[model samples]
Target: MSKVLSKEFLQRWAPLIVLFSLCIIVSIINPNFLSVRNFARLATSSAAPLMLAIGVTFIIIMGSIDLSMEGVMAFCGASLAVVMLQFNSFVEWGFLAIPVAIVFGVAIGFVNGLIHVKLKIPSFLVSLGIGFSCIGLTMVMTGGVRVSASDKAFRLLLTERFFGFPLMVYVAFAALLLAYFIQKKTALGRNLYAIGGGEELAHASGVKVERVRIIAFALAGAFYALGAMFAVAQIGSVASNLGTGFMFVSITSVVVGGTALMGGIGGVWQTLVGVLIVAVISNGMVLVGLPTYIQEGVLGVLVILAVALATNRKAIQLVK
Candidate 1:
Protein backbone atom coordinates (compact mmCIF):
# COMPACT_ATOMS: atom_id res chain seq x y z
CA MET A 1 0.00 0.00 0.00
CA SER A 2 2.79 2.39 0.88
CA LYS A 3 4.68 1.56 -2.25
CA VAL A 4 1.61 2.12 -4.43
CA LEU A 5 0.90 5.42 -2.74
CA SER A 6 4.49 6.51 -3.22
CA LYS A 7 4.33 5.67 -6.91
CA GLU A 8 1.14 7.68 -7.33
CA PHE A 9 2.66 10.63 -5.55
CA LEU A 10 5.72 10.54 -7.73
CA GLN A 11 3.69 10.24 -10.88
CA ARG A 12 1.47 13.15 -9.93
CA TRP A 13 3.85 15.60 -8.34
CA ALA A 14 7.50 14.85 -8.97
CA PRO A 15 7.94 16.81 -12.19
CA LEU A 16 6.18 19.91 -10.93
CA ILE A 17 8.18 19.84 -7.72
CA VAL A 18 11.41 19.58 -9.63
CA LEU A 19 10.37 22.39 -11.96
CA PHE A 20 9.61 24.74 -9.08
CA SER A 21 12.82 23.74 -7.34
CA LEU A 22 14.79 24.57 -10.45
CA CYS A 23 13.06 27.90 -10.75
CA ILE A 24 13.81 28.75 -7.15
CA ILE A 25 17.44 27.81 -7.52
CA VAL A 26 17.83 29.87 -10.66
CA SER A 27 16.10 32.82 -9.06
CA ILE A 28 18.43 32.66 -6.08
CA ILE A 29 21.42 32.51 -8.37
CA ASN A 30 20.33 35.59 -10.29
CA PRO A 31 18.35 38.14 -8.36
CA ASN A 32 16.98 39.65 -11.55
CA PHE A 33 15.65 36.36 -12.91
CA LEU A 34 12.05 37.40 -12.40
CA SER A 35 12.15 40.61 -14.36
CA VAL A 36 9.38 41.27 -16.91
CA ARG A 37 11.95 41.75 -19.63
CA ASN A 38 13.55 38.40 -18.84
CA PHE A 39 10.17 36.64 -19.03
CA ALA A 40 9.36 38.36 -22.34
CA ARG A 41 12.64 37.12 -23.70
CA LEU A 42 11.86 33.65 -22.35
CA ALA A 43 8.51 33.64 -24.14
CA THR A 44 10.04 34.70 -27.46
CA SER A 45 13.00 32.35 -27.10
CA SER A 46 10.65 29.52 -26.34
CA ALA A 47 8.15 30.34 -29.11
CA ALA A 48 9.71 28.49 -32.04
CA PRO A 49 11.02 25.54 -30.07
CA LEU A 50 7.73 25.35 -28.20
CA MET A 51 5.91 24.95 -31.49
CA LEU A 52 8.38 22.29 -32.64
CA ALA A 53 7.95 20.42 -29.40
CA ILE A 54 4.18 20.60 -29.78
CA GLY A 55 4.49 19.34 -33.35
CA VAL A 56 6.39 16.25 -32.25
CA THR A 57 4.42 15.75 -29.02
CA PHE A 58 1.75 13.74 -30.78
CA ILE A 59 4.30 11.55 -32.54
CA ILE A 60 6.21 10.96 -29.32
CA ILE A 61 3.00 10.16 -27.45
CA MET A 62 2.15 7.71 -30.23
CA GLY A 63 5.41 5.89 -29.51
CA SER A 64 7.34 7.34 -32.45
CA ILE A 65 10.14 9.89 -32.69
CA ASP A 66 10.74 12.63 -35.23
CA LEU A 67 14.37 13.47 -35.94
CA SER A 68 13.43 15.43 -39.03
CA MET A 69 12.41 18.70 -37.38
CA GLU A 70 15.68 20.57 -37.71
CA GLY A 71 15.91 19.71 -41.36
CA VAL A 72 12.25 20.51 -41.97
CA MET A 73 12.54 23.84 -40.21
CA ALA A 74 15.64 24.86 -42.13
CA PHE A 75 14.12 23.81 -45.42
CA CYS A 76 10.84 25.50 -44.67
CA GLY A 77 12.50 28.68 -43.43
CA ALA A 78 14.73 28.82 -46.47
CA SER A 79 11.74 28.17 -48.70
CA LEU A 80 9.70 30.95 -47.10
CA ALA A 81 12.62 33.34 -47.27
CA VAL A 82 13.16 32.55 -50.91
CA VAL A 83 9.48 33.16 -51.56
CA MET A 84 9.48 36.53 -49.83
CA LEU A 85 12.85 37.76 -51.02
CA GLN A 86 12.88 41.03 -52.97
CA PHE A 87 15.06 39.70 -55.77
CA ASN A 88 12.90 36.83 -57.03
CA SER A 89 9.66 36.30 -58.94
CA PHE A 90 8.52 34.36 -55.90
CA VAL A 91 8.66 37.66 -54.00
CA GLU A 92 5.55 38.87 -55.76
CA TRP A 93 3.50 36.21 -53.94
CA GLY A 94 2.36 38.83 -51.40
CA PHE A 95 0.33 37.76 -48.32
CA LEU A 96 -0.68 34.54 -50.04
CA ALA A 97 2.97 33.51 -49.67
CA ILE A 98 2.38 32.29 -46.10
CA PRO A 99 -0.20 29.78 -47.26
CA VAL A 100 2.21 28.59 -49.93
CA ALA A 101 4.81 27.97 -47.26
CA ILE A 102 2.28 26.09 -45.14
CA VAL A 103 1.24 23.96 -48.07
CA PHE A 104 4.87 23.24 -48.79
CA GLY A 105 5.30 22.14 -45.17
CA VAL A 106 2.28 19.84 -45.40
CA ALA A 107 3.75 18.26 -48.50
CA ILE A 108 7.03 17.48 -46.77
CA GLY A 109 5.20 16.07 -43.76
CA PHE A 110 2.82 14.04 -45.89
CA VAL A 111 5.74 12.48 -47.69
CA ASN A 112 7.45 11.66 -44.41
CA GLY A 113 4.27 9.99 -43.19
CA LEU A 114 3.37 8.14 -46.39
CA ILE A 115 6.83 6.71 -46.83
CA HIS A 116 7.06 5.66 -43.19
CA VAL A 117 3.66 3.96 -43.17
CA LYS A 118 3.78 2.31 -46.61
CA LEU A 119 7.31 0.97 -46.22
CA LYS A 120 7.23 0.17 -42.48
CA ILE A 121 10.38 2.22 -42.11
CA PRO A 122 11.48 2.97 -38.58
CA SER A 123 10.77 6.61 -37.74
CA PHE A 124 14.32 7.23 -36.51
CA LEU A 125 15.96 6.29 -39.81
CA VAL A 126 13.24 7.85 -41.96
CA SER A 127 13.09 11.15 -40.06
CA LEU A 128 16.87 11.49 -40.11
CA GLY A 129 16.84 11.03 -43.85
CA ILE A 130 14.03 13.56 -44.18
CA GLY A 131 15.95 16.02 -42.05
CA PHE A 132 19.10 15.70 -44.08
CA SER A 133 17.14 16.11 -47.28
CA CYS A 134 15.62 19.33 -45.95
CA ILE A 135 19.02 20.72 -45.06
CA GLY A 136 20.24 19.84 -48.53
CA LEU A 137 17.21 21.52 -50.07
CA THR A 138 17.94 24.65 -48.07
CA MET A 139 21.52 24.57 -49.28
CA VAL A 140 20.35 24.25 -52.85
CA MET A 141 18.01 27.19 -52.37
CA THR A 142 20.62 29.55 -50.99
CA GLY A 143 24.03 28.51 -52.34
CA GLY A 144 25.49 29.75 -49.04
CA VAL A 145 23.69 33.06 -49.01
CA ARG A 146 21.50 34.58 -46.30
CA VAL A 147 18.20 36.23 -47.22
CA SER A 148 16.77 38.85 -44.91
CA ALA A 149 13.18 40.03 -44.97
CA SER A 150 12.57 43.68 -45.83
CA ASP A 151 8.93 43.65 -44.81
CA LYS A 152 8.63 45.97 -41.83
CA ALA A 153 5.16 44.72 -40.92
CA PHE A 154 6.37 41.16 -40.66
CA ARG A 155 9.64 42.00 -38.97
CA LEU A 156 7.88 44.24 -36.45
CA LEU A 157 6.38 41.12 -34.84
CA LEU A 158 9.51 40.45 -32.86
CA THR A 159 9.11 43.69 -30.91
CA GLU A 160 5.50 44.71 -31.33
CA ARG A 161 3.60 44.70 -28.06
CA PHE A 162 0.30 42.91 -27.81
CA PHE A 163 -1.33 43.53 -24.43
CA GLY A 164 1.82 43.20 -22.33
CA PHE A 165 3.85 40.84 -24.54
CA PRO A 166 5.11 40.61 -28.09
CA LEU A 167 2.69 39.56 -30.82
CA MET A 168 4.57 36.32 -31.28
CA VAL A 169 4.06 35.46 -27.63
CA TYR A 170 0.29 35.61 -28.09
CA VAL A 171 0.65 33.45 -31.16
CA ALA A 172 2.56 30.90 -29.11
CA PHE A 173 -0.14 30.92 -26.44
CA ALA A 174 -2.80 30.42 -29.09
CA ALA A 175 -0.92 27.44 -30.44
CA LEU A 176 -0.75 26.05 -26.91
CA LEU A 177 -4.48 26.48 -26.42
CA LEU A 178 -5.23 24.79 -29.71
CA ALA A 179 -2.93 21.90 -28.87
CA TYR A 180 -4.61 21.46 -25.52
CA PHE A 181 -8.04 21.35 -27.18
CA ILE A 182 -6.96 18.73 -29.68
CA GLN A 183 -5.47 16.62 -26.94
CA LYS A 184 -8.52 16.86 -24.71
CA LYS A 185 -11.49 16.83 -27.08
CA THR A 186 -10.69 15.21 -30.39
CA ALA A 187 -11.09 11.60 -31.51
CA LEU A 188 -7.82 11.79 -33.37
CA GLY A 189 -6.11 12.94 -30.20
CA ARG A 190 -7.53 10.13 -28.09
CA ASN A 191 -6.56 7.68 -30.80
CA LEU A 192 -3.01 8.95 -30.63
CA TYR A 193 -2.75 8.24 -26.90
CA ALA A 194 -4.34 4.84 -27.36
CA ILE A 195 -1.84 3.96 -30.03
CA GLY A 196 0.96 5.09 -27.79
CA GLY A 197 -0.30 3.03 -24.91
CA GLY A 198 -0.20 -0.10 -27.02
CA GLU A 199 0.03 -0.17 -30.78
CA GLU A 200 -0.92 -3.83 -31.08
CA LEU A 201 -3.91 -3.37 -28.82
CA ALA A 202 -4.84 -0.20 -30.63
CA HIS A 203 -4.70 -2.05 -33.93
CA ALA A 204 -6.95 -4.78 -32.57
CA SER A 205 -9.38 -2.27 -31.05
CA GLY A 206 -10.49 -0.79 -34.39
CA VAL A 207 -8.16 2.13 -34.35
CA LYS A 208 -6.79 3.00 -37.78
CA VAL A 209 -3.27 3.17 -36.50
CA GLU A 210 -1.65 3.72 -39.87
CA ARG A 211 -4.03 6.47 -40.90
CA VAL A 212 -3.80 8.21 -37.54
CA ARG A 213 -0.04 7.95 -37.62
CA ILE A 214 0.05 9.59 -41.01
CA ILE A 215 -2.26 12.39 -39.95
CA ALA A 216 -0.21 12.93 -36.83
CA PHE A 217 2.96 13.23 -38.85
CA ALA A 218 1.37 15.57 -41.33
CA LEU A 219 0.08 17.75 -38.50
CA ALA A 220 3.52 17.70 -36.98
CA GLY A 221 4.90 18.88 -40.30
CA ALA A 222 2.52 21.81 -40.44
CA PHE A 223 3.53 22.87 -36.94
CA TYR A 224 7.20 22.47 -37.81
CA ALA A 225 6.71 24.71 -40.82
CA LEU A 226 4.93 27.27 -38.69
CA GLY A 227 7.75 27.13 -36.21
CA ALA A 228 10.27 27.64 -38.98
CA MET A 229 8.31 30.59 -40.28
CA PHE A 230 8.16 32.13 -36.82
CA ALA A 231 11.85 31.48 -36.30
CA VAL A 232 12.66 33.23 -39.55
CA ALA A 233 10.42 36.11 -38.55
CA GLN A 234 12.18 36.38 -35.24
CA ILE A 235 15.63 36.53 -36.79
CA GLY A 236 14.65 38.30 -40.01
CA SER A 237 16.70 35.80 -42.05
CA VAL A 238 17.14 32.18 -43.04
CA ALA A 239 20.06 29.88 -43.90
CA SER A 240 20.80 26.23 -44.50
CA ASN A 241 21.49 25.92 -40.79
CA LEU A 242 18.37 27.78 -39.66
CA GLY A 243 17.18 24.86 -37.61
CA THR A 244 20.52 23.65 -36.32
CA GLY A 245 20.52 22.27 -32.73
CA PHE A 246 16.70 22.30 -32.44
CA MET A 247 16.06 18.56 -32.29
CA PHE A 248 18.20 18.25 -29.22
CA VAL A 249 16.72 21.20 -27.36
CA SER A 250 13.11 20.55 -28.36
CA ILE A 251 13.38 16.86 -27.51
CA THR A 252 15.04 17.78 -24.28
CA SER A 253 12.17 20.15 -23.52
CA VAL A 254 9.65 17.41 -24.25
CA VAL A 255 11.43 14.75 -22.24
CA VAL A 256 12.22 17.10 -19.43
CA GLY A 257 8.61 18.24 -19.43
CA GLY A 258 7.90 14.73 -18.15
CA THR A 259 6.87 12.98 -21.32
CA ALA A 260 7.94 9.36 -21.19
CA LEU A 261 10.36 8.19 -23.86
CA MET A 262 8.41 4.94 -24.14
CA GLY A 263 5.24 6.96 -24.82
CA GLY A 264 1.62 6.70 -23.47
CA ILE A 265 2.21 9.55 -21.05
CA GLY A 266 2.65 13.35 -20.84
CA GLY A 267 0.88 16.23 -22.59
CA VAL A 268 1.00 19.84 -23.79
CA TRP A 269 0.87 21.34 -20.30
CA GLN A 270 3.98 19.43 -19.36
CA THR A 271 5.63 20.44 -22.60
CA LEU A 272 4.84 24.12 -21.96
CA VAL A 273 6.46 23.88 -18.56
CA GLY A 274 9.43 22.08 -20.02
CA VAL A 275 9.94 24.69 -22.71
CA LEU A 276 9.77 27.48 -20.15
CA ILE A 277 12.25 25.68 -17.92
CA VAL A 278 14.66 25.22 -20.77
CA ALA A 279 14.30 28.85 -21.78
CA VAL A 280 14.76 30.01 -18.20
CA ILE A 281 17.87 27.93 -17.85
CA SER A 282 19.31 29.44 -21.00
CA ASN A 283 18.53 32.94 -19.79
CA GLY A 284 19.54 32.39 -16.19
CA MET A 285 22.91 30.97 -17.10
CA VAL A 286 23.81 34.17 -18.82
CA LEU A 287 22.50 36.21 -15.92
CA VAL A 288 24.44 34.13 -13.39
CA GLY A 289 27.60 34.08 -15.47
CA LEU A 290 27.76 30.36 -16.24
CA PRO A 291 30.08 29.43 -19.06
CA THR A 292 28.54 28.47 -22.40
CA TYR A 293 30.60 25.27 -22.64
CA ILE A 294 28.99 23.76 -19.55
CA GLN A 295 25.32 24.49 -20.30
CA GLU A 296 24.87 21.61 -22.73
CA GLY A 297 26.37 19.16 -20.28
CA VAL A 298 24.16 20.53 -17.53
CA LEU A 299 21.04 20.19 -19.65
CA GLY A 300 22.07 16.66 -20.70
CA VAL A 301 22.45 15.42 -17.16
CA LEU A 302 19.14 17.02 -16.26
CA VAL A 303 17.53 15.25 -19.19
CA ILE A 304 18.78 11.87 -18.03
CA LEU A 305 17.46 12.49 -14.56
CA ALA A 306 14.16 13.78 -15.91
CA VAL A 307 13.73 10.73 -18.14
CA ALA A 308 14.42 8.32 -15.36
CA LEU A 309 11.92 9.96 -13.07
CA ALA A 310 9.27 10.49 -15.75
CA THR A 311 9.22 6.92 -17.04
CA ASN A 312 7.51 4.25 -14.98
CA ARG A 313 10.20 1.71 -15.75
CA LYS A 314 9.19 -1.03 -13.36
CA ALA A 315 6.10 -1.82 -15.43
CA ILE A 316 8.02 -2.37 -18.64
CA GLN A 317 9.01 -5.89 -19.62
CA LEU A 318 11.89 -4.63 -21.67
CA VAL A 319 13.90 -1.61 -22.70
CA LYS A 320 14.83 -1.23 -26.36
Candidate 2:
Protein backbone atom coordinates (compact mmCIF):
# COMPACT_ATOMS: atom_id res chain seq x y z
CA MET A 1 0.00 0.00 0.00
CA SER A 2 2.81 2.39 0.78
CA LYS A 3 4.44 1.63 -2.55
CA VAL A 4 1.17 2.24 -4.38
CA LEU A 5 0.70 5.56 -2.62
CA SER A 6 4.24 6.60 -3.45
CA LYS A 7 3.72 5.79 -7.10
CA GLU A 8 0.49 7.77 -7.14
CA PHE A 9 2.16 10.73 -5.50
CA LEU A 10 4.97 10.74 -8.00
CA GLN A 11 2.59 10.48 -10.95
CA ARG A 12 0.52 13.35 -9.62
CA TRP A 13 3.52 15.61 -9.03
CA ALA A 14 5.93 14.64 -11.76
CA PRO A 15 4.81 17.27 -14.28
CA LEU A 16 5.26 20.08 -11.77
CA ILE A 17 8.63 18.72 -10.71
CA VAL A 18 9.73 18.54 -14.33
CA LEU A 19 8.51 22.10 -14.87
CA PHE A 20 10.59 23.45 -11.96
CA SER A 21 13.57 21.44 -13.08
CA LEU A 22 13.33 22.83 -16.60
CA CYS A 23 13.21 26.37 -15.25
CA ILE A 24 16.29 25.79 -13.13
CA ILE A 25 18.23 24.16 -15.92
CA VAL A 26 17.39 26.88 -18.41
CA SER A 27 18.08 29.65 -15.93
CA ILE A 28 21.45 28.05 -15.28
CA ILE A 29 22.30 27.80 -18.95
CA ASN A 30 21.12 31.35 -19.66
CA PRO A 31 20.56 33.43 -16.56
CA ASN A 32 18.64 35.99 -18.60
CA PHE A 33 15.96 33.32 -19.08
CA LEU A 34 14.94 33.98 -15.47
CA SER A 35 14.55 37.72 -15.77
CA VAL A 36 11.22 39.39 -15.05
CA ARG A 37 11.11 40.84 -18.56
CA ASN A 38 11.68 37.43 -20.11
CA PHE A 39 9.09 35.89 -17.83
CA ALA A 40 6.61 38.48 -19.00
CA ARG A 41 7.48 37.67 -22.58
CA LEU A 42 6.97 33.98 -21.90
CA ALA A 43 3.55 34.63 -20.37
CA THR A 44 2.56 36.84 -23.29
CA SER A 45 3.65 34.30 -25.84
CA SER A 46 1.85 31.53 -23.97
CA ALA A 47 -1.45 33.34 -23.50
CA ALA A 48 -3.09 32.33 -26.76
CA PRO A 49 -1.68 28.81 -26.83
CA LEU A 50 -2.80 28.33 -23.25
CA MET A 51 -6.34 29.13 -24.26
CA LEU A 52 -6.14 26.60 -27.05
CA ALA A 53 -4.81 23.95 -24.68
CA ILE A 54 -7.52 24.68 -22.12
CA GLY A 55 -10.18 24.19 -24.76
CA VAL A 56 -8.85 20.81 -25.83
CA THR A 57 -8.39 19.68 -22.21
CA PHE A 58 -12.12 19.08 -21.87
CA ILE A 59 -12.37 16.97 -25.00
CA ILE A 60 -9.31 14.94 -24.10
CA ILE A 61 -10.56 14.41 -20.57
CA MET A 62 -13.72 12.93 -22.03
CA GLY A 63 -11.68 10.37 -24.00
CA SER A 64 -12.09 12.34 -27.19
CA ILE A 65 -9.97 14.60 -29.38
CA ASP A 66 -10.50 17.95 -31.05
CA LEU A 67 -8.36 18.67 -34.09
CA SER A 68 -10.69 21.47 -35.12
CA MET A 69 -8.96 24.11 -33.01
CA GLU A 70 -6.82 25.35 -35.86
CA GLY A 71 -9.75 25.70 -38.20
CA VAL A 72 -12.08 27.10 -35.53
CA MET A 73 -9.42 29.56 -34.45
CA ALA A 74 -8.72 30.51 -38.03
CA PHE A 75 -12.39 31.16 -38.75
CA CYS A 76 -13.02 33.07 -35.54
CA GLY A 77 -9.85 35.13 -35.79
CA ALA A 78 -10.60 36.13 -39.36
CA SER A 79 -14.17 36.95 -38.41
CA LEU A 80 -13.07 39.13 -35.50
CA ALA A 81 -10.74 41.07 -37.77
CA VAL A 82 -13.46 41.56 -40.35
CA VAL A 83 -15.90 42.75 -37.72
CA MET A 84 -13.39 45.21 -36.32
CA LEU A 85 -12.71 46.50 -39.80
CA GLN A 86 -16.40 46.83 -40.53
CA PHE A 87 -16.93 48.88 -37.39
CA ASN A 88 -13.84 50.98 -38.20
CA SER A 89 -12.39 49.95 -34.83
CA PHE A 90 -13.03 47.86 -31.73
CA VAL A 91 -13.74 51.11 -29.89
CA GLU A 92 -17.14 51.07 -31.56
CA TRP A 93 -19.64 48.18 -31.36
CA GLY A 94 -16.84 46.08 -32.69
CA PHE A 95 -16.31 44.89 -29.14
CA LEU A 96 -19.56 42.98 -29.52
CA ALA A 97 -17.81 41.06 -32.26
CA ILE A 98 -15.91 39.12 -29.63
CA PRO A 99 -18.97 37.39 -28.24
CA VAL A 100 -20.36 36.98 -31.72
CA ALA A 101 -17.27 35.11 -32.83
CA ILE A 102 -17.48 32.88 -29.79
CA VAL A 103 -21.09 32.13 -30.56
CA PHE A 104 -20.08 31.07 -34.04
CA GLY A 105 -17.52 28.77 -32.52
CA VAL A 106 -20.11 27.30 -30.17
CA ALA A 107 -22.40 26.56 -33.09
CA ILE A 108 -19.63 24.86 -35.01
CA GLY A 109 -18.67 22.80 -32.00
CA PHE A 110 -22.26 21.83 -31.42
CA VAL A 111 -22.44 20.53 -34.95
CA ASN A 112 -19.17 18.71 -34.55
CA GLY A 113 -20.54 16.91 -31.51
CA LEU A 114 -23.84 16.16 -33.17
CA ILE A 115 -22.10 14.49 -36.05
CA HIS A 116 -19.79 12.58 -33.77
CA VAL A 117 -22.57 11.05 -31.68
CA LYS A 118 -25.59 10.97 -33.90
CA LEU A 119 -23.75 9.71 -36.96
CA LYS A 120 -21.56 7.26 -35.04
CA ILE A 121 -18.30 8.75 -36.28
CA PRO A 122 -15.09 8.84 -34.37
CA SER A 123 -14.40 12.21 -32.76
CA PHE A 124 -10.95 12.67 -34.32
CA LEU A 125 -12.21 12.10 -37.82
CA VAL A 126 -15.30 14.20 -37.26
CA SER A 127 -13.31 17.07 -35.84
CA LEU A 128 -10.70 16.79 -38.56
CA GLY A 129 -13.33 16.95 -41.27
CA ILE A 130 -15.03 19.90 -39.64
CA GLY A 131 -11.71 21.65 -39.33
CA PHE A 132 -10.95 21.18 -42.98
CA SER A 133 -14.36 22.52 -43.87
CA CYS A 134 -13.90 25.54 -41.64
CA ILE A 135 -10.51 26.30 -43.15
CA GLY A 136 -11.97 26.17 -46.62
CA LEU A 137 -14.84 28.42 -45.60
CA THR A 138 -12.45 30.85 -43.98
CA MET A 139 -10.42 31.06 -47.16
CA VAL A 140 -13.55 31.71 -49.14
CA MET A 141 -14.77 34.34 -46.68
CA THR A 142 -11.54 36.32 -46.81
CA GLY A 143 -10.83 35.54 -50.44
CA GLY A 144 -7.46 34.16 -49.38
CA VAL A 145 -6.45 37.57 -48.03
CA ARG A 146 -4.97 38.34 -44.65
CA VAL A 147 -7.23 40.40 -42.40
CA SER A 148 -5.84 42.85 -39.84
CA ALA A 149 -7.40 43.87 -36.55
CA SER A 150 -5.03 46.68 -35.78
CA ASP A 151 -7.49 48.57 -33.62
CA LYS A 152 -5.72 50.26 -30.73
CA ALA A 153 -8.40 49.18 -28.28
CA PHE A 154 -8.19 45.51 -29.25
CA ARG A 155 -4.43 45.51 -29.49
CA LEU A 156 -4.36 46.81 -25.92
CA LEU A 157 -4.60 43.22 -24.83
CA LEU A 158 -0.96 42.92 -25.82
CA THR A 159 0.17 46.53 -25.41
CA GLU A 160 -1.41 47.23 -22.01
CA ARG A 161 0.45 45.85 -19.05
CA PHE A 162 -0.73 45.31 -15.52
CA PHE A 163 1.66 44.15 -12.85
CA GLY A 164 4.37 43.67 -15.46
CA PHE A 165 2.31 41.23 -17.52
CA PRO A 166 0.17 42.00 -20.54
CA LEU A 167 -3.63 42.13 -20.20
CA MET A 168 -3.91 39.11 -22.47
CA VAL A 169 -2.16 37.03 -19.83
CA TYR A 170 -4.80 38.07 -17.33
CA VAL A 171 -7.53 37.21 -19.81
CA ALA A 172 -6.06 33.76 -20.27
CA PHE A 173 -5.93 33.41 -16.49
CA ALA A 174 -9.61 34.24 -16.25
CA ALA A 175 -10.37 31.60 -18.82
CA LEU A 176 -8.24 29.16 -16.88
CA LEU A 177 -10.15 29.92 -13.70
CA LEU A 178 -13.42 29.35 -15.48
CA ALA A 179 -12.22 26.01 -16.85
CA TYR A 180 -11.00 24.93 -13.42
CA PHE A 181 -14.41 25.72 -11.99
CA ILE A 182 -16.11 23.63 -14.61
CA GLN A 183 -13.75 20.72 -14.12
CA LYS A 184 -13.96 20.61 -10.33
CA LYS A 185 -17.24 22.21 -9.28
CA THR A 186 -19.76 21.13 -11.85
CA ALA A 187 -21.78 18.02 -12.68
CA LEU A 188 -20.56 18.25 -16.25
CA GLY A 189 -17.02 17.90 -15.03
CA ARG A 190 -17.93 14.83 -13.03
CA ASN A 191 -19.73 13.34 -15.98
CA LEU A 192 -16.75 13.99 -18.25
CA TYR A 193 -14.48 11.96 -16.00
CA ALA A 194 -17.05 9.21 -15.80
CA ILE A 195 -17.30 8.96 -19.56
CA GLY A 196 -13.60 9.06 -20.11
CA GLY A 197 -12.93 6.45 -17.49
CA GLY A 198 -15.48 4.16 -19.14
CA GLU A 199 -18.21 5.34 -21.41
CA GLU A 200 -20.42 2.29 -21.06
CA LEU A 201 -20.13 2.40 -17.31
CA ALA A 202 -20.99 6.08 -17.23
CA HIS A 203 -24.00 5.49 -19.41
CA ALA A 204 -25.03 2.57 -17.17
CA SER A 205 -24.81 4.91 -14.22
CA GLY A 206 -27.31 7.23 -15.94
CA VAL A 207 -24.84 10.01 -16.63
CA LYS A 208 -26.27 11.02 -20.00
CA VAL A 209 -22.96 10.43 -21.66
CA GLU A 210 -23.94 11.84 -25.03
CA ARG A 211 -25.27 15.06 -23.60
CA VAL A 212 -22.19 15.56 -21.48
CA ARG A 213 -19.95 14.89 -24.44
CA ILE A 214 -21.76 17.44 -26.56
CA ILE A 215 -21.66 20.05 -23.81
CA ALA A 216 -17.94 19.45 -23.29
CA PHE A 217 -17.23 20.01 -26.96
CA ALA A 218 -19.29 23.21 -26.99
CA LEU A 219 -17.44 24.49 -23.96
CA ALA A 220 -14.19 23.75 -25.74
CA GLY A 221 -15.34 25.79 -28.72
CA ALA A 222 -15.95 28.86 -26.56
CA PHE A 223 -12.36 28.71 -25.36
CA TYR A 224 -11.16 28.24 -28.92
CA ALA A 225 -12.93 31.48 -29.79
CA LEU A 226 -11.17 33.26 -26.94
CA GLY A 227 -7.91 31.78 -28.23
CA ALA A 228 -8.69 33.18 -31.65
CA MET A 229 -9.33 36.64 -30.24
CA PHE A 230 -6.16 36.50 -28.19
CA ALA A 231 -4.12 35.38 -31.17
CA VAL A 232 -5.35 38.34 -33.20
CA ALA A 233 -4.67 40.65 -30.27
CA GLN A 234 -1.15 39.33 -30.03
CA ILE A 235 -0.28 39.80 -33.69
CA GLY A 236 -2.91 42.28 -34.98
CA SER A 237 -3.37 40.06 -37.99
CA VAL A 238 -5.52 37.05 -38.92
CA ALA A 239 -5.01 34.84 -41.89
CA SER A 240 -6.42 31.46 -42.86
CA ASN A 241 -3.30 30.00 -41.31
CA LEU A 242 -3.59 31.86 -38.03
CA GLY A 243 -4.08 28.54 -36.24
CA THR A 244 -1.43 26.67 -38.18
CA GLY A 245 0.84 25.68 -35.32
CA PHE A 246 -1.73 25.58 -32.51
CA MET A 247 -2.78 21.95 -32.96
CA PHE A 248 0.65 20.60 -32.09
CA VAL A 249 1.27 23.09 -29.28
CA SER A 250 -2.08 22.64 -27.55
CA ILE A 251 -2.16 18.83 -27.83
CA THR A 252 1.48 18.52 -26.88
CA SER A 253 1.07 20.76 -23.85
CA VAL A 254 -1.94 18.78 -22.68
CA VAL A 255 -0.17 15.45 -22.92
CA VAL A 256 3.17 16.67 -21.59
CA GLY A 257 1.46 18.28 -18.63
CA GLY A 258 0.48 14.74 -17.54
CA THR A 259 -2.89 14.26 -19.16
CA ALA A 260 -3.36 10.74 -20.48
CA LEU A 261 -4.07 10.26 -24.17
CA MET A 262 -6.39 7.41 -23.20
CA GLY A 263 -8.26 9.95 -21.06
CA GLY A 264 -9.83 9.69 -17.54
CA ILE A 265 -6.93 11.70 -16.08
CA GLY A 266 -5.50 15.20 -15.72
CA GLY A 267 -7.13 18.65 -15.61
CA VAL A 268 -6.68 22.31 -16.48
CA TRP A 269 -4.01 22.99 -13.88
CA GLN A 270 -1.85 20.25 -15.36
CA THR A 271 -2.51 21.84 -18.72
CA LEU A 272 -1.30 25.20 -17.41
CA VAL A 273 1.90 23.56 -16.20
CA GLY A 274 2.24 21.82 -19.53
CA VAL A 275 1.90 25.09 -21.42
CA LEU A 276 4.47 26.71 -19.18
CA ILE A 277 6.79 23.78 -19.71
CA VAL A 278 6.53 24.08 -23.46
CA ALA A 279 6.94 27.83 -23.27
CA VAL A 280 9.99 27.43 -21.09
CA ILE A 281 11.53 24.90 -23.41
CA SER A 282 10.92 27.07 -26.47
CA ASN A 283 12.26 30.20 -24.83
CA GLY A 284 15.18 28.37 -23.27
CA MET A 285 16.14 26.85 -26.59
CA VAL A 286 16.15 30.25 -28.23
CA LEU A 287 18.20 31.69 -25.39
CA VAL A 288 20.66 28.80 -25.67
CA GLY A 289 20.79 29.22 -29.44
CA LEU A 290 19.16 25.84 -30.24
CA PRO A 291 17.57 25.55 -33.66
CA THR A 292 13.79 25.55 -34.10
CA TYR A 293 13.96 22.07 -35.61
CA ILE A 294 15.69 20.81 -32.50
CA GLN A 295 13.05 22.37 -30.32
CA GLU A 296 10.31 20.62 -32.30
CA GLY A 297 12.11 17.32 -32.11
CA VAL A 298 12.56 17.69 -28.37
CA LEU A 299 8.87 18.42 -27.91
CA GLY A 300 7.96 15.35 -29.96
CA VAL A 301 10.14 13.14 -27.80
CA LEU A 302 8.64 14.65 -24.65
CA VAL A 303 5.15 13.84 -25.89
CA ILE A 304 6.05 10.20 -26.47
CA LEU A 305 7.61 9.90 -23.04
CA ALA A 306 4.67 11.59 -21.39
CA VAL A 307 2.23 9.23 -23.07
CA ALA A 308 4.19 6.21 -21.97
CA LEU A 309 4.36 7.45 -18.39
CA ALA A 310 0.66 8.28 -18.24
CA THR A 311 -0.55 4.99 -19.74
CA ASN A 312 -1.35 1.89 -17.71
CA ARG A 313 0.38 -0.63 -19.93
CA LYS A 314 -0.31 -3.59 -17.71
CA ALA A 315 -4.03 -3.31 -18.30
CA ILE A 316 -3.75 -2.87 -22.03
CA GLN A 317 -3.11 -5.66 -24.50
CA LEU A 318 -3.83 -3.64 -27.62
CA VAL A 319 -2.00 -0.63 -29.07
CA LYS A 320 -5.08 1.08 -30.49
The per-model lDDT (C-alpha) reads 0.84, 0.91
- TM-scores of the models, in the order given: 0.93, 0.97
Best by lDDT: 2
Model 1: ten consecutive residues of lowest lDDT: 86-95
The parts of candidate 2 lying over 4 Å away from their true place are 1-5
Model 1 misplaced stretches (Cα beyond 4 Å): 1-5, 86-93
Clashes of each: 0, 0
Relative to the unseen true structure, what is the C-alpha lDDT of residue 177 in candidate 1, on a scale of 0 to 100? Answer: 92
lDDT of 2 by residue, 123-216 (tens): 9999999999999989998999988788899999999999899999998999999999999999999999999999999999999988888888
